[model samples]
Structure formats: structure tokens, C-alpha cells
Target: MKADRIVSVIFILIALVFWSQTFGLQYNCSIFPHLILIFLILSSAIMFAQTFFAKDIKREHLSGKDLKYIIISIAIVFVWIYMLDFLGFIVSSVICLSILTLILDQKRPMPVRTLSSVAIYTLMVLVFWFIFHKFLLVPLPTGYLI
Candidate 1:
């Protein structure tokens, strides 16, 4: 079995499991998990299709720096998820976005980086505030400061 095929199979299996679990959960309760399930399934389908249908299967070697970036990205996301509730979405997200942008855009101008981080964080906060507070009527997370 080729590496790409193996990864594709694993993704398909995981997607199936997530899809099943989504159905097993109580209906009309939490929509977030369901949306995540759909995303997983869709992504898996794309991966599987790409692996099977694409003619080229030549594996490209990941440079050390590329691997480091990938690992850091995953770590940042994990930390963001863990800190979201405790730190509140705004603070946790701002930190995550700032750090990620800095890591990914090291060569960019300082002003550009700062403005981009502030804009991204502000947009995320506004979106979450609008969706949770206004649309869904769910209470926004109030951190220790609040």
C-alpha cells in the first residue's frame, strides 16, 4: 500500500466514524459538532478523491523548517482550543492570531504585521460576538478580567 493510499484510507475511516458519532448524538441540540463532522467528511472525501484520481503520487520531502511550521501550527491551534473558554474567545484568539502571523510572516514589515494581527483579531471578535450574542443568543465567554 502506498503512503498516500494509506493516509487516504485512514481519513475515510475517521470521517466515517465522525459521521456516525454525529448521527448518534442527540438531535437538534448542538450544531457545532455536526458542522465539524460535515467538515471532516468533506475534507476526507477530497483527500480520498485526490489520492485515487490524481495521476501523480510522487511524495515530496518536507523540509525541517516546513515540518517545524506544521508542528507549530498544530500546537497553536490546540492551545487556542484549550484556552478559548478560560481566556475568553477574544483574548485567546488575539494571542493565537498574533503569534501565528508572526511565525508565518517573519519577513513582512513590522507595521504590516501589527496591523494585520489587529485586524484579524478584531474581525474574529466581532464575528463571534455577533453570532453568539445576537444570532444564537448564547452568552459570550467572560474571562477573568470581565
Candidate 2:
């Protein structure tokens, strides 16, 4: 499909740009990003190839509800990035995660569900905090409260 080809080309270009940028970074900083970029490029290329070779496609379309959910999820990530410097990583991450969880599982009661979501996300954040700070020796962003 035209859309698939376009997306594949765009991803290839983006991967190339990122690959070029990685060359300017220090070895330690560039290694992981380079690895991920290479993986992305290879996967995109393989997918594009498969698109050409595929016998048939179901041509399933995204529902309006699904599209809205995608937009909301993307918006949450952008807002989380913007809030990171001001609110710090832990707080922003937990808040973003809780919100996404609530959005994803809206069938449950709001009050009880919200609290459970927050608790789950808080535990997740703590685990990440420990891994990043202690094991990886990477510093986490800390706001006034933390």
C-alpha cells in the first residue's frame, strides 16, 4: 500500500538521521542508541519488504475510539515530557502512568480504580528508581518533594 511505503520510507530516513547523530556522541552514550536505531532500520526494512511480498492484507481500519485512545496516549506522553523538568521524573512518570492505566481500564469504578492504578504505578516507579539509581548508577530527576 502507498501508506505503508510512505511510512517505511519516513522511518528509514528518521533512522538514518538518528544514526548520523549517534556518530557525534561519546562511545558510551552512543552504543545503546546505535543498537536500537539499527534494530529499527532492519525491522522497518523487513516489514516494507513483506508488504511487497504479502499474498493479501486484511485492510483492517482503526476505529474512532481506538484512534482517540492513540491520540490521548500520545498527548499524555508529550505532556509528561514537558512536565518532567518542572515536576521531576518520578512524579511526572507516576502521574502519566496512572492516567494511562485509568484511560485503558475505564470499566471499573473510578475512585477505587484510580487508587489501585496509582499504587501499581508507584511501585513500578520505585522499582525503576532503584534500578536506575543503584544498579545502573544513573541519577534520576528529583523535584522538591522527592
Q: Give the count of colliding residue pairs in each prediction.
A: 0, 0
Off by over 4 Å in 2: 21-29, 55-71, 82-87, 110-116
| lDDT of each candidate versus the true structure | 0.78, 0.86
Q: Which stretches of candidate 1 lie over 4 Å from their true place?
A: 18-46, 74-87
lDDT by residue for model 2 (7-115), tens: 8889999999989888778989998998899898998898789878876667779999999999999999999888878888789999999888878775875788689
Every candidate's CA RMSD: 3.7, 3.2
What lDDT score is found at residue 93 in candidate 2?
A: 95
- Alpha-carbon lDDT of model 2: 0.86
Please state the error at residue 80 of candidate 2 in Å.
3.3
Clashing pairs in 2: none
RMSD of 2: 3.2
